[model samples]
Target: MSEVPTTRPARGRPRDPGIDARVLPAAVAELAEKGVSGFSTRAVAARAGVDRRGVHARWATSEDLVVDALATLTANLRPPLTGTLRGDLDDLVPDVARALSGQRRRVLQRCLDEVGDAPAITERFRRDHVDRCTAVLEDAFHRAAGRGELVAATTPARATEVLMGSLLLRALTVGDDAVRGDALDGVVDHVVALVSTSAPGARS
Candidate 1:
């Protein structure tokens, strides 16, 4: 008799499993429209059609809710990695810069201005948002290295920081509109050139 194969059951919620799932988007929308300092759980509840207590039960505080919701929204909008390290950075950097054109950047700036003094809130932003972005870039670089596009000594973490940090500064300055296409393309070409030249055989 042939043995029947059994597949493992899927783990965790298919996606978002929290009670916050329903209200999370609304909370993020409120923060984007109103800024972090201006958000109210009651208002979020009204928009989400759930009671204020429901939001509180899931997120506990306005800071927690806003941070988690924004993180989720940002995650959804991240650009796909284009396989090669340079291509991936090119794809990601401009889209990230473009995201500043939205209301979300105002929310982020407001949070920084008001909650910068709050260690826990700031830490959560660093851990949840900043680290995740860094990780995505790192993973892309690692994939390129596996494909022989990255050199043996070019560290994914260090290279990712340089690319992402530079783009963040540019985005902060660009503000209110998409980054100029020429400048964005210049960044991508320049970074790709640097990485390609750093690879072992490119110069020879």
Candidate 2:
């Protein structure tokens, strides 16, 4: 007798690409509004206008969804390149300041708070947010070097650290008002001055 062939049943409707687009933004909005403690798959599904099953199908848990959503948001933010290092760095300051404050800040704090429970989420956040930011600055520095605008001793990582650290401090300690005011301008000016001073053939 010939062997019989078997076929498995389909696992429900095909996944919708548009659902992902809607769900990611909805997840971010939910986290911004409700925080980790209040965030739920049901709420995200409702917000996205997708079936709860769709959300669960894509993500195993609310934490997973949150991590993915935050990653999506961070990945979309690229530092502007204005053909000059100072111009590019200046262009990035306001956005960096904005990210460190407001709803984004609260969402970040909540992520930190939940790190013990979701270490993977923390790692993903670091890779998605911190690493990407560093990469952008590093690229800018390399471009400056290629243009002979940066000194041999200038370190992209160190410069990124200094600029980001200062902005974070201002955002977390002095508040967003400082970030939005002349303080931000002062910080950008200081970084630019430091870079200019350290550049090749700069006046001491």
Q: Pick the candidate with the highest TM-score.
A: 2
Predicted candidate 2 versus true structure: per-residue lDDT over 40-134, tens digit per residue:
88988988899999888899887789878887545244767788888887777677677777767777777667778767767877877778766
Kindly give the number of clashing pairs for every candidate. Answer: 0, 0
lDDT of 1 by residue, 135-204 (tens): 8777887777777776554677766876766666666666544354777777666666666545445641
Global Cα lDDT for candidate 1: 0.68
RMSD of 2: 4.3
Off by over 4 Å in 1: 1-22, 32-38, 47-49, 77-83, 146-154, 176-182, 198-204
Per-candidate TM-scores read 0.68, 0.75
Candidate 2 collision pairs: none
Q: List the residue pairs that clash in candidate 1.
A: none
The regions of model 2 sitting more than 4 angstroms off are 1-11, 14-17, 33-38, 75-81, 146-148, 151-154, 198-204
